[model samples]
Target chain A: AQSVTQPDIHITVSEGASLELRCNYSYGATPYLFWYVQSPGQGLQLLLKYFSGDTLVQGIKGFEAEFKRSQSSFNLRKPSVHWSDAAEYFCAVGALSNTGKLIFGQGTTLQVKP
Target chain B: VTQSSRYLVKRTGEKVFLECVQDMDHENMFWYRQDPGMGLKLIYYSVGAGITDKGEVPNGYNVSRSTTEDFPLRLELAAPSQTSVYFCASSSDRNTEAFFGQGTRLTVV
Candidate 1:
């Protein structure tokens, strides 16, 4: 069984400020990792994913995450966040054994203040 | 030039719900669930990651699915085990992650 723990429930940052959302996972083997975003009333959207190779994986909307084997963490970071960047972010673990079933974290609600 | 089919490769945004395609596709039903009405909940399944379920509750399948139930990726009587007293039981759809009607919304006061 796999699960994700997102320490932060909600985050607030200035529009131009940098942002970092932490994520930790529990898995038997090296698992597939992903980050997704959701607006006020919408579906979950993929921001980035880490499957293999390159500890650091870049994704859409200038977002990126690093897979740290030692820490068992894949944290999402952005140099500067835009107003639209404010949304709910989730960390997911996609197990190889399971085709595409992702175990998701509770989710962090990001608030970008202008 | 290639003519677009009824199926549009509609590029929406970074917010894409793409059930990723893998080369060695050994499907074990990969479902990404989302609550329908109020809050987001586990309301969808992917009998096979690539195959969209058929019509209504339709198990419409695609050709890319592999057969290997030995994986034993079955969903039977799972429990979130929240303090919420109400218990709701309903069959789920392993189809598109976006479309699902009749969802259960349980809130604990």
Candidate 2:
């Protein structure tokens, strides 16, 4: 079965500091990976996705993710974190058979400290 | 106005309805839409009007796609465990990114 795992449950970083959130996925074939961010009491917003192509993918809000086939990981990164950047992040694996069907990771809550 | 934004309260054992509508002319619609609690689990999804599929967790829930614009989820017996935020999303096709609604927070007591 295809699944996603976010190892960090909560992470705190100082404003302007670099950030990296780890994500690992389990799938039998080439995977379609995605990263989503959710503000408090709001719906999720797509940050980035990796379908096929370059390993490094850029997304909205200055976010970027790298898909490493060898490790089965699609980790999200941002050079500088802002106060407004704090949000819950989720990594997901899209089922190849079912286009939109996704298996999501538990989630990592990011807190920005000044 | 935020899409699919609402707060609902229902008593246990009561039948509950959660409605979602999209104006984007999307071909796919999903329910139990996003992450809350354990993570976002798909309860049901529809490829098109009158074409729906059960997802990861579908027991005690029923869904219908009445039209291209509407897809509603029905909880046969509302339970406290059912208290969670529900999201709705739609996408143009298999390869395209999906658009999400603000979400509906449902509390069953």
Candidate 3:
């Protein structure tokens, strides 16, 4: 089965500090990858994704991810963290994708210390 | 707009649990998984339609398609994986994305 791994369990960054979240995946071939954010009392939102083309993909809310196939990793980054950026981030892989199932990572909770 | 909604029975603030889609296509899903660390992968989905959407909420899950009917979500919480299952799709391309639910739950027993 294809799967995703998020190394960072929890991260505490200053409101103005930079941020990065790591995600690793196990699959037979290059698979569809995604990053989502979940805030308190909210739903999971799409941050960015890496499927093909540019190794660096930009997304909403000033977020971006660099896909390093050599490392089997797609990392999310933001130049500066914001207080509102505090949330749980997830790295996911589309598995049984032909079947439409999405395998998600354990998730990384981000805490912004103002 | 009258959007679709998903429901279940969950506590205050726990992670996990997901939701629904369609087998007709290969996208979208609804989940109601629970238990230890990760829980059961509930509500697996692939979009049954063609539309594109990002998450409307932080913990919620949703998606859209470009050429088919996509998997939208309506969530409450999470339930057991033994409950029900149907309509799940999965397809991937450069700009295409997957589908998911915010998850619905009702922890009993």
**Pairs clashing within candidate 1:** B29-B47, B31-B46, B35-B41, B45-B94, B53-B60, B54-B58, B54-B59, B54-B60
- Candidate 1, residues B1-109: lDDT per residue as tens digits? 0111112122222121222232333343332334322123232334543443321121211222333221111222223322111111111221112211221222212
Tens digits of lDDT, candidate 3, A1-114: 677888878899999899989999888887788898877544567788877899999999999999998898999999999899998888877664354446778788899998
Per residue, candidate 1 scores C-alpha lDDT tens digits across A1-114 of 577889998899999999999999999998788887877544456688887899999999999999999999999999999999988898877644433455678788899999
Clashing residue pairs in all predictions, respectively, total: 8, 0, 58
Top-down TM-score ranking: 2, 3, 1
Candidate 3 lDDT tens digits, B30-67: 33232223412433332334433332122343433343
lDDT of 3 at B80: 45
TM-scores of the candidates are 0.59, 0.95, 0.66
Q: What TM-score does candidate 1 get on C-alpha atoms?
A: 0.59
Cα lDDT for residue B92, candidate 2: 78
Docking category of candidate 2? medium
Each prediction's DockQ against the real complex: 0.09, 0.64, 0.19
Whole-model Cα lDDT of every candidate shown, in order: 0.54, 0.86, 0.59
